[model samples]
Target: MFNKWQAQRWWSENYDRIKELYNVQRLNRNAFALPTPPISEDEASS
Candidate 1:
């Protein structure tokens, strides 16, 4: 049988770990950052 309270309790218990994992993954993706695109000639003259 499905229990909503049980699901909520499990999620609450694991929320911190889930958030930490997500942050680590995001940081890893950002660490090897992409270079910005080159500016247009008109913009450079302004």
Candidate 2:
């Protein structure tokens, strides 16, 4: 698990890329069966 500071830093550094990947994953998941778990349930609604 990440400490609070490390988590914050990682989010700041990777949020945009993470969002892009999450969207791609969501699209692919909808199109077919995907084994990967979701990034977050909150993201799925947006």
Kindly give the number of clashing pairs for every candidate. 0, 0
Question: Considering every candidate listed, which one attains the maximal lDDT?
Answer: 1
Q: Candidate 2: deviation at residue 6, Å?
A: 0.4
Please give the distance, in angstroms, between residue 34's alpha carbon in candidate 2 and its true position after superposition.
32
Each model's lDDT comes to 0.83, 0.82
- Clashing pairs in model 2? none
Looking at model 1, residue 32 earns an lDDT score of 81
Give each model a TM-score: 0.42, 0.46
Report the lDDT tens digits of candidate 1 across residue range 1-46: 5499998998899988998978744357676898899999999999
Error of model 1, residue 13, in angstroms? 0.5
Q: Quote the RMSD, in angstroms, for model 1.
A: 6.0
- Tens digit of per-residue lDDT, candidate 2, span 1-46: 9999999999999988998987744355466775697679789788
